[model samples]
Target chain A: MNDFEYLEPATVAEACAMLKRYGGEARPYAGGAYLSIVMKQGLIRPKALVNIKKIQELKGIRFDPSEGFVIGALATHRELETSQLIREKLPILCAVEREVANIRVRNVGTVGGNLASGEPLTDLAQVFLALDARVAISGPSGDRTIPLEELFVDLYQTSLGEEEILTRVIVPPPPPATGIEYIRFSSSSVVDKPCVGVAVRISLNADRKTCGTVRIALGCVAPRPMRAQGAEALLTGHPLSPQLVEQAAAAAAEECSPISDLRGSERFKRGIVRVLVRRAMAVAYDRASHASTLRLRSGQAGSA
Target chain B: MKKQIRLRVNGMDRTVEVAPRTSLLEAVRDQLGLTGAKLGCDMQVCGACTLLLDGKPVSACSFLAVDADGSELTTIEGLAAGDRLHPLQEAFMDCGALQCGYCTSGFILTAKALLDEQPRPSEEQIKDYLGGNFCRCGCYQEIIQAVKKVAGI
Candidate 1:
C-alpha cells in the first residue's frame, strides 16, 4: 500500500471535518479489509486516511421496542453472526454472515464498510433492503437519514456525499407474519464472490392465503444490487401459486442486467437468478404463512 | 511517516513503529521477528496469515498494524507453554495433519479460535470454520481429524 498520513477522528463530527479538510484527497478507513486491498493494488491513492474506528458513536448493536435494530457502523461481521439479539430476532442475518468470505474476513469486516463500499458482489445491502433498513449519515452539511435502497447509486459507488460518514443502519423490525430469505449462488467454489444473490421478503395477508407485500432484492446482477420490481409487482396482492412464482421468477430474470464473466455467462446468471428467485420467494412465503418467525410489532413496510 | 503503537503480542507487550501502509503481517514477521504467520494470499481470502486479534481470527496480511494498538494479539508462537506444545499443535503432529507446513500455523490458529468458541463443535461446524484456510498439500482430512481430536468429538 502507498504511504499516507493516518488521521484518527474521535467523533462523527470530527471525522466529517477531517474529510472535508482533505476533500477528495482523503478516504474514510474502517475494517481495513476493503481499503487495504484496493490501496495495495494502486487502484486508489489517497493522501490521507481518516481512520474512523475510534469514533465511539459509530459502534454497538442496539434494539428498541419501537426502533427495531440499530447496528453500529463499525460493528464487525463476526459480532453480527454471534449477536444475541440478531440471532434471536434476525436469525437470517446470522446465517448469511456465516457465508460471507471467511472466518478471518468476517472477524474484522464491518457491516457498514461492506455496504458503504458499494461493491456489487456483496451480500448485506440486498438483504438489508429486503428488511427495509435505513442508514444514518453525518457530514459537513448536517445529519441525514435515508433508506438503504437509496444508498447504492452504482458499482463501487454510493449516494453518500464526499464528507459524509455512514454512522448506523436502522432496520425496522419485520412485522408479524413476515418472512425473509436470502439465497447466494457461486459459480465456482463456495467462497467465491456471489454469481447471483436473491433476497426475498414476504408478508402474508390475513387468512394467510394472499401475499400482501413482496420484496425481491437481487445482488451481483447489475451495476448495483437492485430490487426486481417487475417480479415483485407480479406477486404482490396475489395468492402465490406455482405458476405465479414461475412467472415472477422469469420476470426477475428478464429485469436484471447480468454481464458475462468468468463466474458465469450473462445467460447462465439470468438462469440462476430465475431459479434462486423462485426458491427464495417460495421459502420466504412458506415461512410467512407458517408465522415461524413472527415477532409482533407495528411499523409501516419500507417503500420499494 | 512512522507512528508508534503498542500491542500485547503473544502475552508480551511491545511497541512497534510502522507506517500507515504497513500490514500487521509485516510488523509481526519483521519488527517482532515472529515469522510463524505466513504471508500466503496478499488478499484476505486465504488464511495463511491468520492471527487471533482479541481472541478472534483475522487475516494479518490485510489487517492494519496500526489497528492492533491497545489490542491483545496471538501468533502461532504463543500457542505453546514453555516446551509443551498447545493441544492443537500436538494433535496436528499426532494426526500427521501437515505435509508442507506452510498453512499449518494459519489452520492451527483458526482452529484454536473455533475450539475456544465451540468446545465440541459438530463435524459440520468444524468444516465451516476451517473451510477458508487452504491446505494446498490437500491435508484436509487429517487436518479435520487433528481438530476433532483436540475437541474430543
Candidate 2:
C-alpha cells in the first residue's frame, strides 16, 4: 500500500466534487479489497482515495414488484446472499453469491465495486446481464442508467468515467412463470477462475410445456459477458424439447470465443459451456413449469 | 505523510500517528504493541489477519490504519474476560483444534462471528462460514467439533 491521502466524504455530492477536483489522480474506495490488491501489484497508483462507505445514498436494497429491484452500490455480496427478497425473487443470484470467494470476502465485497472493476470472472456481471439489469452511475454532470451489457467495454475496463461513481443497480423483475439458473465450471476446488459460466432465465407458457421468452448470458468465455442471442432465439416461443435444448447449447458453445488461459483450454471451456448451458436450461425449465404451483401454494398458505 | 488516527482496539481507545498506507495489522502489532492479530499474507488471501471491524470480520492486513478512525475493533486478545478464556478458546484447547497454532487467532475470530450469529449452525454451514480461513495443519475436523461442542449441539 503506497502512501496516499484519504478523504472520507460524507455525501455523494462531496465525493463527486473530490473526484472532479482530483480528476484521475483520485480513486473512489468501496470495500478496498480489489483496489488494495491492485495497488500493491502496481496496476493502479492514485494520489488520493475518496472513501465512500460513509455515503448513505450508496447503501441498502429495495425491491418493488411493480418498479423492480434496486440494489445500492455499497451493498455487500453477503447482504445480497442473505436478503429475503433476493432469495425469494431471484434464487439463482443466491446460488452464484454463495460461490463468490467466501464469507469473509463476501462480507466486504460490494456489488458496485465488483461490477465497476469489470473483472471477467465476476459472477454478478453475468447474472445481471442475463436479467437485463441497469447500472445507475453518478458523474460530475449527473446520474445516468447504462444497461449492463453496455457498461463493460472490455476486460478490467468499463464505461465509467474518472469522476463517475456507480450508485445502484436496477434489475427488472422477471415476468410471472419465469425461472432462472446459473451454472459454472471452476478450475480449482475453490472456484478461483471460472472456465465458463452460464446464466439462463426463461418464462414458460400457460400449459407450462413451452417457453414464452428466454435470456441467456455467458461469462469468462468472451472479452465481456456475451448474450447467446442465437441460442436464446431458438428457445424463445418454442417447446423446450431435449433435442432443441441440445441444439441451443451447441449454438451457445459455437458462438463463444474463449481463449486458453490458466483456468482451462479454449476447447475445454467450450465443452463446459455446452454442458452448463444444457443443464442450466433444464433447471430453468423445471422452475418455470413449477412456478405456478409454487405461487398458488404460497398464496393459499398466506391466506390460511 | 503520517496522519493521526484514533482507534478503539479491544476495549481501550488509543491514538497513534502512522504513515497513510500502514495496514491496521501493522498498527495493532507494531505501533500499539498488540500482536494477537497475526499477519500471514499481506494480501487478503490468507485469513491470518482477520479481526472484527464494528462486529464484522474483515482482513486487517488489507485495511488502512486511517480507516479505523472512530471505529470499534476487536482482536483475539479481547475474546477472553479477565483471567478466564472465552468459551471458544477453551473449546479449541479441549478439542485440540490447533496444530502449530499459526492460524488459531484468525480462525477463532471468524468462528466467534459465526457462533455469535448462529448459536447452533449445521455442520455444512460451519464449513461454509469458515471457508475463507485456511488451516494448513488440517485441524478443521477438530475445530468443527470444538465449535459444535461450544454451541451445545
Candidate 3:
C-alpha cells in the first residue's frame, strides 16, 4: 500500500472536519477489507486516511418498537450475526450475516463500510434495501437521512458527499403480517461474493388472499443493487397464485441487466435470478400467510 | 509517514513504528520477529494471517497495524504455555494433520478461537469455523480429526 498519513478522529464533527480539510485527498477508513486491497494494488492513492471507527457517534445497535432498529455504522457482520435482538426481531438479517464471506472477514467488516463501498455484490445492501432502510449521514451542514436505495450511484460509487460520513442505518419495523427472505447464489462455500442475490419482502392482506405490499431487490446482476419495481407492482393488490408468481418472476428477470464475470456468464445469472425470484416469492408468501394466521388466532384468544 | 503504536502481542506489550499502510501481519513478522502468522493471500481470502484482535479472529494482512493501537493481540506464538504445546497444536502433531505445515499456524489459531467459544463443537461447526483457512496440502480430513480430538467430540 502507498504511504499516507493516518488520522483518527474521536468524534463525528472532528472526522467531518478532517474530511473537509483533506477534501479528495483523504478517504474515510472503516473496515479496511476493501480499502487495504485496493490501496495495495495502487488503485487509489490518498494523501491521508481518516479513520472513522473511533468516532463515538457511530456505535451500538438499538431497537425501538415505534422507531424501529437503529444500527450503528461501525457494527460488524459478526455482531449482527450473534445479536440476540437482531435474531429475535429480524431473523433474516442474522441468517444472511452468518453466511457473509466466512468468519474472518465478517469479524471486522462493518455494515456501513459495505454500504459506503457501494460494492454491487454486497449482501447487506440488498437485504437492507428490501427492508426499506434509511442511512443517516453527518457533515458540515448537519445530519440528513436518505433511503438506502438512493445511496449507491454506481459500481463502487456512492452518493455520499465528499465531507459527509455515514453515521447509522435506520431500519423500520416490518409491517404486520410480513415475511422477509434473502437468497444468494454462489459457486462454492469459499466464494464470498454472490453472482446473483434476490431479496423478497411480502406482506399479506388481512384475509391472506391478496398481497398488500411486495419488494423484490436483485444484487450482483447490475452495476447497482436495484428494486424490481415492475415485478413488485404486478403483485400488489393481486391474489398471489402460481401463475401470478411465475409472471412476476419473469418480470424480475427481464428487469435486470447482468454482465458476465468470474462468478458466471450473463445468461446464467439471468436464469438464476428467475429461479431465485420464484422460490423467494413463494417462500415469502407462505411465511406471511402463516404469520397472519397465527396473529389472527392470538387475537381471537385474547378476546375470548 | 511513520506512526508509533503500542500493541500487546503474546502477553508482551511492545511499541513499533510503522508506515501508514503497514499491515499487522507485516509488523508482527518483519518488525517483531514473530513469524508464526504467514502471509498467504493478503486479500483477506486466506486465513494464514489470522490473529486474535480483542479475542476475535481477523485477517492481519488486511488489518492495518495502526489500528492495533491499544488492542490486545494473540498470534500463534501466544498459544503455548512455555515448553508445553497448546492442545490444538499437540492434536495436530499427534494426528499428523499437517503435511506442508504452511497453513498450520492459521488453522491452529482459528481452531483455538472456535474451541474457546464452543468447547465441543460438532463436525459441521468445525468445518464452518475453519472454512476460511486453506490447506494446500489437501489434508482436510486429518485436520478435522485433530480439531475433533482436541474438542473431544
Candidate 4:
C-alpha cells in the first residue's frame, strides 16, 4: 500500500468538499474491505482517502409499512444480518448477508461499499433489483434517487459519477401476496464467490391461481447483475406450475452470458442458474401463498 | 505522511506514529511490539490477522491502523490475566487444539468474540463464527471441542 493523505469529514457536505477539491485523486473510504485489498494488490492507488464512515446520515436501518424499508449505506453486513427490521421486512437480504464471505468481512463490509465496489459476485444488489429498490445518491449538485438496477453499469463499474456517493437504499414494500428468495451456487467453499446467483420475487393475484407480477434477477453470470426479462415474461400473468417453472428456468439460463472462470465453467454456470431459478421460484411461490393466507386472516379478524 | 494514532490496546492506552499506509497488523507488530496477531495472508482470506476492534473481529492485516482511533483493540496477548490463561485459552491447551500454533491465536481470539456474543453457541453457530479462521495444520475437530468445552455445549 502507498502512503496517502487520510481525511476524515464529519458531515456529508464537508466530505463532498474534500472530494471535489481532490478530484480524481480522492476516494470515499467506507468499510475498506474491498479498497484495501485492491490497493494492497497494487491495482489502484488513490492519493487521498476521505473517510465518510463518521457521517451520521449514512448509518441506520428503518422500515415503514407504507414507505417501505430504508437502509443507510454505512450499515455493515453484520448489522443487516442481525437487524430485526431487516429480518422482518426483507428476510431474503438477511439470508444473503449471512452468507457473505465470512464473519470478519461481514463485521466491517458496508452495504454501500458492496454495491459501490461493483463486484459481480455480490448477492445484495441482485436481490435489490428484484425488489425494485432505489438508491439515494448525494453529489456536488444535490441528491438524486435512481432505481438500483440502473446504478450498475458494467464489470467493476457503476453509473455513479466520480463525485457521487450512494448514501441509502430504499426498497418498496412487497405487494400483497409477494414472496422473495435469493439462491446461489458456489463452486468451492461456501464463502467463495458464487458461480451463479438468482433472485426471484413473485406475487400471486387475488385468486392465487395466476402470477400478478414476477421479477427474476441473475448475478455472477454477466458483466453486471441483470434481470432475466425473457424468463420473467414467461411467468407474468400466467399460471405457475412445475412445467412453467422449468420453462422459465431454461429461459433465464439462456438469458445469461457467462464466461469461464476459476469458480466454474461457463456451461456449469448456466446449469447452476437454471437449477437455482427453479428452486427459488418454488420457494417464492410457497411463501407468497402463505402471505396471502395471512392477509386474508388479518382482514377477516379486523372485520369481525 | 506519518500520523499519531491514539487507541487502547488490551486495556492500555498508547499512542503510536505510523506511516499512512501502515495496516493495523503492521502497526501493532512493528511499532507497538505486540506480534501476537500474525500476518498469515496479506489478503483477508485467512483470519491469522484477526483482532477484536470494539468487540468485533476484523482482519488487522487489511484494516488501517489510523481508522481504529478511539477504538478498543484486543489482540491474542490480551487474553491472559497476568499469567492466568483465559478460559478459552485453557480449554484449547487441555484439548491440544493446536499443531503449528500459527493459527491458534487467531482462532482463539475469534472464538473468544463468538462466546462473548453467544455464551452458549450451538455446534453449527460455533462452526459458522470461526469459519473465517483457517487451521493449516487441520486441527479443526480439536478446535471445535475446545470451544464446545468452554461453552459447556
Candidate 5:
C-alpha cells in the first residue's frame, strides 16, 4: 500500500481522461474490496487511482423493457442482493449473491469491479454468462459493448485496455419459460471462495417438454469462467432426460481444467463440478417447466 | 499524497489526513482514537475490522479511509449512550455472547447493522448475516441468543 494520488472524477469522460493521462500508471478505484487486498500485498501499485465512485452514470440498476437489466458498474453486491428490479426479473441472481463473500464485502464490492478484476474464484461471471451478460467500457477511443466472457482474459487479467473503464453490465431479460440456476461448491467454510461453481440456464419451447436454448457456465475450474460448450451442445434443442442430463454432466466434468489448491484437489473439483452441473441443470429444467407457477413471489424474493 | 477527508464518526464530525493507501481501520484507530475496530486478518475474510458506513457493515481494514469521505461511520464505541448500553450490547452481556473479546466489536457492529435492517430476522438469516465473523472461542450459541433476545424472537 504505497502512497499514490487519488483522483475522483464525477463523470465517465473525465474518468477516462484521467486514466488516459496516467496510462498504465492509473487504475479505476471502485469499492476497493478486492483491489485493496491485492494492492496491500504489493501486487499492483498504480501511480494514481481514478476513483470512479462519484460518477453518476455508473451507479444505478435499471430495467429496460427491451434490453432487460442495465446494471450500473458501481451497483454494490448488497444493492443487487436487495434490488426489487433484480428480484423481479432475475431472482436467481439474488439467491446466488446472498452467498457471495459476506455482508461486509457485499456492502461495498461492486459488480463491475468484481468482473473487471478478472478473479476466477467468482460466482457472478458464471451466473452472468448463463444469462448472456455483456459489459460496456469507456476509453480514449470511445465506448464499446462486449460480451462479459470476452472481457475475461486470464488470471486477474481482462481484455480491457489500460485506459478502458468498464461502465455497465447489461443482462438481457431471460426469455419466457427460461430458467437459470447457479450453484457454488465451497470446499471448506461457507465464506471460503468457491471450489467449483456451475451455472445452468435452460429455455424450454412452447411445448415445455424440450430445451430450446441451453447454457452451461462453469467457474473456479479454469483461469476464467467459461461456457461448457460441449456439455451445452448435448442439451440444446433436445429433451432433458435423466440419461441426457447425466451425459451432459459427465461431459462438463471432463471439459473443465481445474488445478489443485487450498479449496480442493483437481479431481475433487471435477467431481464437484459434475455434481453441481447436474444438480443445477435439473433445478433449472424444473423451473423452466413451471416458470409461470414457480416464480418466487415478490414477498419471498425480498426475504433473502 | 495525503488527503483530508471528513467523516461523521460515532455521530461526531471529524477530519483526518490520510494517504491513499491508509486503511479505514488505521485512520479510525490512529487519528480518530476510536479503536474498537481491530485489524484481525487484514484480509476481508475476518470481520474484526467491521464498521458501519452509512449503516451498512464494511470491512474497514480493506476499505480505503479516504473513500469514507462524507459518510457516517459507526463503530462499537457508538452503540452506547453516555453510560447506558445499547439494547444489543445489553443482550450480549446478558447472554454471555463473548469470551476472549477479540472478535466482539466486529460481531456486535455487524449484528447491530443486521438488527437495524431486519428487526425480526429468522434464525437462518442471523447465521447467514453473521457467518463472516469468526469466533475462536466458539461463543456462537450465545451470540445467536443475544441477537434473538434483542429481536424478541
Candidate 6:
C-alpha cells in the first residue's frame, strides 16, 4: 500500500470538515475490508485515510415495528447477523448476511463499506433495493436520505459525493401479512462468486392465498441491483398459482441484461435468476401464510 | 514515518517504535520475537496470521501495528498455560489435526475464538467459522473433530 496520512477524527463534524478540506484527497475508512484491498491493488491513491471506525454515532442496530430499522454504517456483518431486532423484523437480511465472506471478514466488513464500494455481487444491495431501503449521507451540507434506487449510478459508482460519508441504512419493516426471502446461485459448491441473487417481499391477502403486493429485486445480473417491475406487476393482487409464478419468473429473466463473465455466461445467469426468483417467491409466500395463520390463531385464543 | 506503539500481548505490555506501514504480523514476529503467527499470504486471504484483537480473531497481515495501540492482543503463544496446553491445543494434538503444522497456530486461535463464543457448536457451524482460516493439508475432518472434542459435543 502507498504511504498515506492517517487522521482519527473524534466526531462526525470534524470528519466532515476534514473531508471538505481535503476533498477527493481524503477517503473515510470504515471496516477497511474493500478499501484496504483496493489500496493494496493500487486501484486508488488517496492522500489521506480518515479512520471513522471510532465514531460512536455510526455503530449499532436498532429497530421497531412501528419505526422501522436503523442500521449504523459502521455496524459489522457479524453484528447484523446476530442482531435480535434484525432477526425478528427483517429475517431475510440475516439470511443474506450469513453468506457474506466469512466469520473474520464479517467481523470487520461494515455495511457502509460494502455499499460504498458499490460491488454488483454484494448481497445487501439486492435486499435493500427490494425493500426500498434508504441510504443516509452526512457531509458539510448536513444529512440527507437518498432512496436506494437513486444511490447506485453504475457499476462501482454511487451518488455519494467525494466528501460525503454514508451514515446509516434505514430498512422499513414489511407491511402486515408480508414475507421476504433472498436466494442466490454461486459458481461452485462454495459461494465464491454469486451468479444471480433474487430478493422477494410479498404481502398476502386475508385468506393468505393471494398476493396483495409484491416486490422483486435482482442482483449480479445487472449494472446495478434493480427491481423486476414487470414481474412484480404480474403478481400483485393475483393469486400465486404455479402458472402465474412461472410466468413472473420468465418475465424477470427476460428483463435482466447480464454480461458474460468468468463466473458464467449471460444466458446462464439469466436462467439462474428465473429459477431463483420462483424459489424465493415460493418460500416467501409460505412464510407469509404461516405467519398469518399464527396471528389468527393467537387472536382467537385471546378472544376466548 | 515511524511511530511508537504499545501492544499488550499475552497479558504483557510491550512498547516499540516502527515504520508507519509495518503490519501487526511483522511487529509480532520481527520486533517482539514472537514468531508463532506465520506469514503465509501476507494478505487477508490466508488465515496464517490470525490472532485475537480484543477477543475477536482478525488477520494480522491486514491490520496495522499502530492501530493496535493499547489494545488487548492474544497470539498463539498465549494459548498455553505454562506447562499445560490449552484445551483446543491438547485436542488438536490428540486428534492428529496438524500435518505440516505451518497453519497450526492460526487454526488453533480461530478455533479458540469459536469455542469460546459457542462452546458446543454443531459441525456445520464450526466449518462456517473456520471458512476464513484455510488448511492446505486437507486435515479439516480431523480439525473439525478436534474442535468438537474440546467443545464436548
Question: Chain A TM-score for each candidate, in the given order?
Answer: 0.95, 0.92, 0.94, 0.94, 0.96, 0.92
Which candidate, 1 or 2, has the higher lDDT?
Answer: 1
Better of 2 and 4 by DockQ: 4
- Model 6 sits at a Cα RMSD from the real structure of 4.7
Model 4, global lDDT: 0.87
- Model 2 has a DockQ score of 0.69
RMSD of each: 3.4, 4.1, 4.6, 4.5, 2.3, 4.7
- Every model's DockQ: 0.89, 0.69, 0.80, 0.81, 0.90, 0.54
What ordering of candidates by DockQ runs from best to worst? 5, 1, 4, 3, 2, 6
Q: Write the per-residue lDDT of candidate 4 for residues B28-74, one digit (tens) a residue.
A: 99988998889998888889999999999999999998899889999
Between the candidate structures 4 and 5, which one is better when assessed by DockQ? 5
Candidates in order have lDDT scores of 0.89, 0.84, 0.86, 0.87, 0.89, 0.82
Alpha carbon RMSD to native, model 2 = 4.1
Every model's TM-score on chain B = 0.99, 0.96, 0.97, 0.98, 0.98, 0.97
Residue A153 in model 6: shift from native, Å?
1.6
**Top candidate when judged by DockQ against the true structure:** 5
Across A194-234, the per-residue lDDT of candidate 3 in tens digits comes to 87888888887777768998999999988999999999999
- Please tell me what DockQ candidate 3 reaches: 0.80
Stretches of candidate 2 exceeding 4 Å from the true structure: A64-66, A191-193, A205-207, A293-304
Worst 10 residues of 6 chain B by lDDT: B16-25
Please give, for residues B30-97, the per-residue lDDT of candidate 2 as tens digits: 98887877878777766889998888888888887787788888999999999999999999999999
Interface C-alpha root-mean-square deviation, candidates in order: 0.8, 1.6, 1.0, 0.9, 0.8, 1.8
Clashing pairs in 3: none
Candidate 5 clashes between residue pairs 3 or more apart in a chain or in different chains: none
Across A1-304, the per-residue lDDT of candidate 1 in tens digits comes to 7889899999889999999998878899899889889999999999999999988989899896777799999999989988988887888888788888898888889998999988999788888988989999989899999999899999899999889999999999887789788888888877778888889999888868888889999999999989999999999889999999999999999999999999899999999999998888878887888785455221111111
How are the candidates ranked when ordered by TM-score, highest leading? 5, 1, 4, 3, 2, 6
Ten residues in sequence with the least summed lDDT for candidate 3 chain A? A295-304
CA error at residue A131 for candidate 6, angstroms = 1.9
